[model samples]
Target: MVKMGVEEGEVMQHSMLTKSIERAQRKVEENNFGIRKRLLEYDDVMNSQRTVIYSKRKNALFGERLDVDLNNMIFDVAEEIVAEAKEQGNFEDFQIEVIRIFAITPEITAEEFAQGKIEGLTDRLFEQAINAYHHKIDAIGALTVPVLNNVYAERGQIVENVVIPFTDGIRGIQVSANLKKAIETNGKEVFKSFEKGIVLALIDEAWKEHLREMDDLKQSVQNAVYEQKDPIIIYKMEAFNLFKSMLAAMNKDVVSFIFKGEIPGQETTSLQARQVNQAPVKTIETKAELVSPTGVSEEDVNDGPKEPVRNENTVGRNDECPCGSGKKYKN
Candidate 1:
C-alpha cells in the first residue's frame, strides 16, 4: 500500500511539470507570432516609404521635362504645366499627354512605354501634336461655292456677303468668310423678288383706282364750268384748276404733283373740286328757262313748261335799263 501511494504521488508531480512546460511553450509561440507580425509591419512601412521617395524624386527630376514635352506636343506654351499624382508611382501624368506629343520614346528609355495597345490614331494624333510645336501653320483652308443662275448668266447680277474676323492677340486668326456665297435666283432669292413684285403691284393698283375716281370727279366739274359760261371767269378759273389737279392725280407716277399755284394767263381747271365742294354757287333757274333747251341738257329735264311770270319792268333796253331805275344814260 505505501509503494502504490508513492507511485501515485510521483505521477501527479510529473503531470504538473508537463502542464507547466506546455504553458511556457505556448507563451513562446505567442511571443514569436508578435515578433513576426512586427517585422512584417516594419517591412510594409519601409516599402511604402521607398515608393513615396521614389515618386517624389521622379517628379522632381522629370517634372520640368514633362512640361517641356507637353509644350512641344501641344504647341501651347514654352514652359507648360505637367501634372503629377502622389499615389500612382511615377510619371503617370507625364505619360498621359506624352503619347500624344511624340512617338513612344521606346529607344530613349530602357523600359517599354505603357501605351502599346491604344489605337493607331491615338499615336498619330500624339505625334502630330509634337510635330505641330515644331513647325508653323502653313495649311491652306478650303471652301466650295456652288454655281448659281445655271452656273452662268448672260446678264444677271449678284451681290456677295463679307466676313470680318478680329485678330488682336491670338496665335492664329483666320478670316473665314465666304467671299460671295452663291444663292440661285431660283431659290429664296427668287421668292423674295416675287414678294416685292406683288407688294409693288398692290400699291400701284391702289393708287391707280384712286386716281381714276378723282379724274372722273374733275371732268364733271369742268362740264359744270362750261355750262356756267355766262358766270364769272373766276368760276372757270376754278374749273381749270380742278382739271389740272385731275391730270396730276391721274399721272402722279409720271409727275411729281408739285403745285406751282400760278394759274397763268390761261386758267387751269384744278381748283374746281375744292372750290365747288367748299362754297355755293347760284344761277337763274325756272320752269320756263329750261323747257326748250335741247342742244344739250346737262341736268335732268322737264317735258312741259308750267308758266311764265309777267312784271311791270318788261321795258325796252333803252327804258331805265330794265333794272327798275327811273334814270337812263340818254334820258
Candidate 2:
C-alpha cells in the first residue's frame, strides 16, 4: 500500500510519492532512448525485406511460387507485425522463438545434442526431424500441466506464512513505520523503527511530554514488582504482561510487535526499552586523542608514516677493489 504525507506550514517539499513519480519519469525517459535504438534496427530489417520484395518482383514468374519466392513473402509479412505485439514480445517472433527453443529440450537427448547434428539436411532428413519433434512434444505436453499445478501449490504455502487472517477478536493497531528509506533506496540496512514503543497522534512537544510521563510510569511499575519480594516467575507476569494490556488499552493506534522468535530472557525483557541510548564503545578511536585534562593542542601530535633512511658507506665506486673490475661504477 502507498500513502502520502502533508504539512500545513513551513517547508513545501516533495513527499515520498512525488519522489517516486520523479524517479519513474527518469526511468521511462532512459528506457525510451534504448527503445528508439531498437526501433531503428527493426526499421533496417524492414527496409531489407522491401529490397528483397522489389528484387523478386523484377522476376515475372511470381504466382504462388514455390521455394525462394514463398520465403521472401513470409519474411515481408513477419517484418510488418503490430506494434502491440512488438512491446508484448521479447523479440519479433517471441512465441515461435520460445517454442522452438523449448522444442529442443525434450527431443534429441542432451548427450546427442552435444555430439552435434550436421547441417544442410535433405527432404527425407526433414521428414525424420518432423517425426522426432512430434514424439518429444507429445511426451512433454502429457506431463507439463500437472507439474505446473504442483508449482502453484507450493506458492500457496509460501503466501500463508505472510498473511494471517484478521478476526473480530483480533484488534489492529495501525502504527506508522517510515519504510521510505528502505523501499525507496532498496537498502537492507535502512530500517522501519520507532523512538520507543510510544506512538504519537501528532509528533509535537505536547505528545513527547506525555510519552515521558508514560515512560516514568512504566519504569515505576517495573520497580514496584521487584519491591514486592515475590517469586520472579509470578512477578514478571504482573509487571510486564498486565502493563502491556494497559498500554494496549490506552490507544487503538500502538502496535504490539515482537521480532521473530525473540522471546524475552528470564532475566531481561528487551534491553532496548531502557531510558537512554548509549553510543557503543567501538565508536571511540583510541589512536586519536580528544581534549584531555592538560591544556594541550591536538594539532601538535604528528600522525604520518616515517621516511626510510638512506644506507651509508655501502660502496666507494671510484676506489672499489671488492671485485677488482676496471669498470668501477658500472659494476
Candidate 3:
C-alpha cells in the first residue's frame, strides 16, 4: 500500500509537470504574447508603492541640499505630532510626546501652556525643537553642515570615509581619508566626506519593517470575508492606513536616530541602496522557434500566399520575361 501511494504521488507530479509544459508550449506557439500580458497583470498595485518608495530613496541619495531637506522633514514630523495631539486637547501629553520623539524637552511650563492658545503652545514647541537642534550643533562647532568620517582599522592603517547626512534621510559620501595623514590634511573633501549615515539607515530599516508588516497584513486580511465583510475593500483601506503609519514611523525613527544615535564610521557604512540596470536579452530566432501571438496579431487572415510583385521594373504575366528571352509568360 505504501509503494502504491508513492507511485500515485509520482504520477500526480508528472501529470502536473506535463500540464505546465503544455501551457508553456502553447504560449510560445502564440509568440510569447500571453507571457507579456500575464506579467503586466501581475502585482500591479504593489509596483506603484514600490515606485514611490524607490523615488524617495533616490531623491535622498542624490539630492545636494541637506539643510532644506532636513528642515522640511522636521517640520513635517512636527506637524504630524501636533495634529495627532490636537484632538486630545491635552497640552501635557503633547509636550511629552514631542520630547519623546525629538529628544528635546519643551521649555514652556504647563501653566504657560494652559494660559495660552493651542497655536501659541505649538509655536513654542517648534521653537524649542529648532533651538535644541541648533544648540547641539553649536556645541559641536557644526553651525554649518556636519561632516562625518567613518574610521576603521585596515592592514595596520586607519581608513576613513566621509559621510554627509541630508534632511530627507538620504546620505552622501565624499571620499575616504587615511588616518595617518588626516590631521595634517584637513581638506574640504575630508570634511565634506563626513555625513549623517544614521538617518538613512533608520529610514530604510523602518521602511523594510513596514513592508513586512504590510505583507502580513495582506495575508491575514483574506479572512475578512469570513467576517461578512468585503475582503477587497478591507484590504485597500487597511493597506492605505498601513502606508500612512509606515511613513509616520519612518519620520520618527529618522529623527530619533539622527539626534541620539552615534555617528556611523568605518565601523558603520553608508546606507544607500545599490542600483542596478537590467534588461531582458533577445535571442536569435530559428524557423522552428514558436512565439505566441495575442488575438489582435492572429485575428486577420487572408489565406494563401500574398500577391507577387508587379512593379514598373517587373514583368507582367503577359509581358516578356526580365531575362529578355523573348518568350511570353505562358511560354
Candidate 4:
C-alpha cells in the first residue's frame, strides 16, 4: 500500500510540472503572434501607399492618354491657385501664381477677382494653360524639326535613334526617340516622349524621397509610446499628411516642368555653357574683431600673454612690505 501511494504522488507531481511548461509555451507563442500581427499592420500602411504610387507610375509609363493626364493636372493646379488666392483675398497674388506656374499672365483683372464672381476662372485658366502648353510644343517642334531633318538626311540609313535633351532648370535628362518616326510624325513623337519622360522622372524622384520620409517617420513615431499615444495611429495620420503633401508637390512640379521646359537653342546653350565655364564667386570670409569696452580687440587680448593672478595677502602701505626689504612702515 505504501509503495503504490508513493508512485501515485510522483506521477501527480510530474503532470503538474508538464502542464505548467505547456501553459508558458502557449503564452510565449501568443506574445510572438501579437508581435508579428502588429508588424504586419505597420507594413500594410506602407503597402497601400506603395500601391498608389506604383499605380500612378504605371499609368504615366504605359497609358495612351498622357495628354488627358496632363490636362487634369493643369486643372487641379488652377483650382488650387484660385482657392489660395480666394483665401488670401489677394488677386495680384493670383496673377503672380498663374504667371509663375503656367508662364502666362492671367487675363482676370483685380476688380473681377474682388467681385468674387470668379467661379469660371479655373476653367478659363485651364484653357489658357492648355493653349500655352500646345504653343510651347509647337515652338519646340519648329526649332528642332529642321535640325532633325538635317541629321536624318545625313545618316538616314545608319541612325535609328536620336537623343533629345530636356531640362527643368534643376535637372536634365536625355530622351531617345526613333529618328525616322519623329520625322514621320512631325515631332509629335518627340513631344510625347518629353511628356512621358518628365512625368516619370518627377514621380520617381518624389516617390523615392517620400519613401525616405516615411522610414524616418516610422522610427520617430515609435517614441509616441512615451506619451501614452498609440504609435500606429500617429504614424497613420502623419503618413497620410506627408503623402498628400508629396503628391501635391509632385503634381505641381510635373505641370510646371511641362509648361516651362524648352529645347535649348544655340543662344541659350551658349549662355548655359558660359555660365558653367565662369568661375564661382570667391566668398571672402572676414573675421570681425570684437573690441572690449577698454578698446582692446578680443583677438589681441586672447592671443597676448595672460597675466598671472596674484592671490597673496594685501600689504597695507602703512603696514609695510611684502617685498622683503620690509621696514615696518611706508618708507
lDDT of 1 by residue, 174-202 (tens): 12122223242223322222222222333
- Cα RMSD to native, each candidate? 49.3, 36.4, 27.3, 14.3
Better of 1 and 2 by TM-score: 1
lDDT of 3 by residue, 171-232 (tens): 43222333324333433332322323444455678778877887787678779878998655
After superposition, the stretches of candidate 2 with alpha carbons farther than 4 Å from their true spots are: 1-20, 58-331
Q: Model 4 Cα displacement at 322 (Å)?
A: 69
Off by over 4 Å in 4: 1-13, 117-119, 267-331
Residue-by-residue lDDT tens digits, candidate 4, 1-331: 3665675445455788799999999999999999899889889999998998787778779865677777878888988998899889988899889988888998778877777544687877888888888888887777667767876786567556666777766677656566778788778777788888888989999999998999999999999999999999999999999998998888889888887777666432322112111132432212322456687776776896779998987767688676777686578
Q: TM-score-based ranking, best first?
A: 4, 3, 1, 2
Taking the candidates one at a time, how many backbone clashes does each contain? 13, 0, 22, 0
lDDT of 2: 0.33
Clash count, predicted structure 3: 22
Indicate the worst ten consecutive residues by lDDT in candidate 2.
Answer: 159-168
| Candidate 3 residue spans exceeding 4 A from truth | 1-42, 64-66, 115-120, 142-196, 227-229, 262-331
Task: Please report the candidate that would top TM-score against the real structure.
Answer: 4
C-alpha local distance difference test of each model: 0.34, 0.33, 0.55, 0.77
Regions more than 4 Å wrong, model 1: 1-13, 55-331
